[model samples]
Target: VARLQERARLFLELATQRGLDTGLSRGSAVIPVIIGDSALSLRLADRLFEQGINVHAISYPAVEEHKARLRFFITTLHSPDQIRFTVDALATTLSELRQEALYITPTN
Candidate 1:
């Protein structure tokens, strides 16, 4: 458990430094990042899954309003490389999405 927590700390720190909106640290095994868009959240989750990381995307109605997010669980079986890969993949996916203008915008 300690090793997993340590790895989670590294991931959370890197994610926070990249300006990702991660929720307050509770030292729990699950790390939650608010993605705002359900579609983007799911896509990011799928990207991570493709890289062999298991995560889940939570959308409105599944949780309270405005809480859409991708939830990543830290397990003892995960290696440092896997954690780094997941974070890197997340950064790459978001960057690609942004460059592609795939995010929704206000219709006004």
Candidate 2:
């Protein structure tokens, strides 16, 4: 449990430094990176999945609306390198998605 907690702390710090909203962590194994938009959250999750990182995108009904997030679980089995890689991938993927959103025109 201690190792898990330590990894979680590291993850939170790295994620926060990268501007990812990780305000839902309590120094536990579970860390929630709040994206605030349901579509963005799901896109991030799917993008991460394509990159081989599997995490759950939590949205309304399970959590409050507009507080959609990707929940990350840090375990003892995960090394520091793995955590860093995951964070890097998440940041990159999210940035890409935000950039894409900027140019998306409404069809209506």
Put down candidate 1 lDDT per residue, 1-108, tens digits, no spaces: 789888888889878877777878568778888887777777778877887778899987896647778888888888888888788888887777666665566696
TM-score of each: 0.82, 0.94
Clashes, model 1: 0
Cα lDDT computed for each candidate against the true fold = 0.80, 0.90
Clashes of each: 0, 0
lDDT of 1 at 6: 89
Kindly list the per-residue Cα lDDT of model 2 for residues 3-107, writing each as its tens digit. 888898889889988999987577688889998888889888998999889899999878886788999988999999999999999998999999999999999
Weakest lDDT window of 10 consecutive positions for candidate 1: 97-106
